[model samples]
Target: MAVRKIEHVGVMVTDMERSIAFYRDVLGLETLGTLDHGNGTIKLAFLGSPGAGETQLELVQGYTGRLAEEGKVHHIAFTVDDLDAEIARIAKLDVTFIDPDITVLPNGARYRFFYGPDGEWLELFQPA
Candidate 1:
């Protein structure tokens, strides 16, 4: 079995439109596409990266039953060229944030989280 590169990261959001705005407008990530997976069971939105498709964010919604509450996922972080710039961009949307600025680590990388709708944590970090 050949494993492929991560196509996108799946995030569970209680509110699709609000989360879309948070990721698209606030973060400046371009929208690639969105799809309704029939019977109102699932909704998906694909977000493109600054480099015009280097990465993506798959926004998933409308699924109930486990993993909807706390402790399921602590956070989901996306790598950025300039963590500071991305942080500032999202801050404009006034999306609730944790450590609004980049926090330095001993390894020389930085990180921060912008709390999303329904407590879905969104993270921006620079990898070493």
Candidate 2:
């Protein structure tokens, strides 16, 4: 068997429009399209930067059960060229940051955590 790369990451959201706006407007991602599954039991909206190929963030709607905890499968990280600028942009939106300061890893990478529209943990990572 062979593994190439990640195609996309799917996130179950409560509201489609709000989630779409958070990713599209706040994160500066482009909406590729949407898909409906199980006769509308699930709706997915694909979003990513232009020319990003198969790497995308899939926002899903329709599930009302319990969600995963913060450090579990509910977290997603995005690599940014300018973490400070991205954080400033995100501050203008209605998002909440978990840490008041950016965390520097042992390798010198910087990262900060924030919550999405649905309380999903999102991270901004900057490589050293």
Candidate 3:
């Protein structure tokens, strides 16, 4: 059978509040709500843009430190209508860009990388 689109990306976060703020406030994603599992041993916050069936970013608590490593998932990317506008908005949050400047791929698509509150790699991609 053919596979459907990704439902969400599960991210392990060190600080639930900060991670939620980053995804909800900084990125401007809507909070779908939170979940308590394992009798409160685990906490998860679901976030996504406004609109039905959008892929969500799930932030899970109960982990310490970063989980991303080389040769791993690398980064989660989000599409932006205006990369420059998005960059300016994110700059107010004091987020550091991994690249000195946006990179243009061979196909002419533009992208830049940054880190989330829990040091999770994230990318902003603009199609050609």
- Our model 3 lands, by Cα RMSD against the true structure, at 13.8
Candidate 3 on 73-110: residue-level lDDT in tens?
A: 44576777677878878989999888899977544667
lDDT by residue (47-87, candidate 1, tens digit) is: 87667755578787877766736544445667777767776
lDDT of 2 by residue, 16-123 (tens): 899999988888998988867545677768798978675678787885577655332445667777788888888888679998989875447687889888777777
TM values, all candidates: 0.49, 0.52, 0.49
lDDT of each: 0.69, 0.73, 0.72
Q: Is candidate 1 or candidate 2 better by lDDT?
A: 2
Pick by lDDT: 2 or 3, better one:
2
Give the worst 10-residue stretch by lDDT in candidate 2: 1-10
Q: Which stretches of candidate 3 lie over 4 Å from their true place?
A: 64-128
